[model samples]
Target: MTLNAAPRGLYFDDFEIGQEIVTSARTITLTDIVNFACLSGDFNEVHTNFEYCKTTAAGEPIAHGPLVYAVAAGLQYATGVNDGTLLALLQIDGWKMLSSVKHGDTIRLHSRVLEKKESSKGDRGVVTFLRQIIKHDGTTAQEMTAKYLYRRRPKA
Candidate 1:
């Protein structure tokens, strides 16, 4: 992949099992939650009602878990790691929500390459990453293992 300055794109061969990639941070806003709710049809009270959440362990309205997952995936794309020939996004498995993500809470994502293997077809390779969504306080709120298929760079 052609590397750019801001997005931090990484090519197919640039990733290793333990390499960590950090993305630009974003804060979850009430508007964001409401918009997501409208789009996804998840209007759970805990996610949209402050009064209801006040009595819950979250203690406040929180962002949807799927929204947080989307942000983590967006981080990988925004950081330039998704450049070049991306054959497919294979899967995102083993997702876990470790903490509540509230409105106004800033979050960042970090992905560590967990495995890489050449495809039998030889045109692409599989890359699996351990993705973590962490709050500004460095607490992990979400985690997942995402896998993708990337076309190998043409031999010179």
Candidate 2:
């Protein structure tokens, strides 16, 4: 799905339960894996070593789960409402790593808004969603349920 280029802050009125937001695709390259390994200090052989993978059940080098999650979260942020309107990401629950992502895999994230409610103490409301990270070929790699605090629309 093509995202809006115009910056529109997501307000309480913008989200509806059961609405799905599809994020842009991002491809993971070898350089991305190596760079992520250096930045995150995760030097696990399963992610960085093809030789080690030959002995493991994965049978080949794989991307780190967190790295894949970061890509997915980036997509979620680019959806416009979360980055422009969010005060904070309050909670993330039920995050499951389902499949292995190898190098050169292009992935996409899809988010379904599950609930919305006004916060009692804050000027914002809470938006919660179930997010799915899918491979370019349509395999689901990971999923998460996350909640964020988003600003309410200003009084006109």
Give RMSD to native, each candidate.
Answer: 3.6, 4.6
User: What lDDT does each candidate get?
Assistant: 0.85, 0.86
Write down the RMSD of candidate 2 (Cα, Å): 4.6
TM-score of model number 2: 0.90
In candidate 2, clashing pairs total: 0
| Residues 106-125, model 2: lDDT tens digits | 99999899999988865679
Q: Put down candidate 1 lDDT per residue, 33-105, tens digits, no spaces.
A: 9999999999999988889888999898899999988877787678767765677889989889998999888
User: How much does candidate 1 score in TM-score?
Assistant: 0.90
> Could you tell me which residue pairs clash in candidate 2?
none
True-vs-predicted CA distance for residue 18, candidate 1, Å: 1.4
The alpha-carbon root-mean-square deviation between model 1 and the true structure, to one decimal in Å, is 3.6
